[model samples]
Target: MTFYTYGYLTTHHNTWQYARIGLLIALLVVFIGLFVHYLRNRWNVKYKDLSIITGVLLLLVLGLQINSLVSLQSATKQSGEISATVQQAAKHLKVSPSSLSINSTSVSDNLLIKSSQGYYRLDYNTDGSAFILEKVTLENPKIKLVKE
Candidate 1:
């Protein structure tokens, strides 16, 4: 992962998630501390039972958080791959990203990039699990603006 990917993950990519994670962490600490205080001040069977319940809840929340992180990581990885591919294509063609354009909507996830130098095709699986760049020839490429 590049620094750009990390930046997007922290800043641009579903910013609400990071905030939610932070809030959950704070609540977890506060509630756990409260439970510990109760247990320390007075020994009770009910408090111990509730503490066990809290432990189970903690595990569940952690599992869910891991699931959320996995989804976020996958989405970010895909976006990063696309961005890197476009940037690489631009560099290979000796042009800046602003001078480059790509079209992918009709290509089933693969990209057809256009630049003044030539054409470059970024081929990848439809599932976005992989991508590769290749020099291509297109007579009349109807590429729209997608210079990531």
Candidate 2:
């Protein structure tokens, strides 16, 4: 599914996220096992110390990954709101959202909407405090407005 935010559009990959987290967890478990083995064998103090440090670093990275996942979920919610608003606007212009070509940039809040019926744009202010309809250009024949 395509996710539209203030500045850009993103594609969701549900399976990839889960796979990445699972891989990290597996690596952490393997590291822990190795750490225990080194300590039990008393092979080298340096090896044991290195393993402990590596384990701590992995834990820190795992925490960061979880935090990022939470942030992404919130962003997805905001994207849904933006998408709904766009669909409503398209209905007002008598066109399906699917029929329009949407263009968004990562550096700007403006979204360009274009279709055979006309061209339009909307600007979503920072923090989503406001949504401004920047421009609307209807075709010369002017299609019949359809309310959905």
Candidate 3:
């Protein structure tokens, strides 16, 4: 898996970064609590047992932290894809994304569609006046702009 660092917090929209940081803080608290408890009840448990317990707990927390990071990455990728699709649609329509209303059932012959749940298969005519939206699962969908 490729890993890229999103500087500070903006790259992740402060979502994943906050979660991962929270987990790290939790892990630190757990470790400190265990150490303090051991100090206060020195006669209750053996050193070897305490060591093993601490090791196991640390491993569990580390696993959870890793899972949280992975989930954040997946969410970020999905959002990025949506943003790219919106940009592509704007380019084809020659209008801002805010001005376009897209529906699955809406057929088009001139628009380049980028769908979150569909593959990228774009078709453009030689004259650049018309095109068909072809998806792997969806049948031939076409779009034509209404000229003023």
Maximum-TM-score candidate: 2
Model 3 misplaced stretches (Cα beyond 4 Å): 1-24, 37-41, 46-55, 99-148
Best-to-worst ranking by lDDT: 2, 1, 3
Counted clashes in each candidate structure: 0, 0, 7
Candidate 2: tens digits of C-alpha lDDT, residues 76-126: 776566566666666767776666545532324656565666556777777
Best candidate, lDDT-wise?
A: 2
**How does each model score on lDDT?**
0.61, 0.61, 0.51
State the weakest 10-residue window (summed lDDT) of model 2.
Answer: 1-10
TM, every model: 0.53, 0.59, 0.44
1-148 per-residue lDDT for model 1 (tens digits): 0112222322345666777687668657856876886778676666666666766777777777788899888777766555666566667667676565555312345456666776666777668655676788867544434212
lDDT (tens digit, per residue) of candidate 3 on 1-148: 1111112111336455676677667766766776777788888676447656766777776787788778767766754544454456557646554443333222234323433444334565776444454655546745442211
lDDT value, candidate 3, whole model: 0.51
Candidate 2: Cα lDDT at 78 = 62
For model 3, give the 10-residue run with minimal summed lDDT: 1-10
Candidate 1 lDDT at 148 equals: 21
Judge candidate 1 against the unseen true structure and give its global Cα lDDT, from 0 to 1.
Answer: 0.61
Model 3 TM-score on a 0 to 1 scale: 0.44
Candidate 3, residue 4: Cα displacement in angstroms equals 26
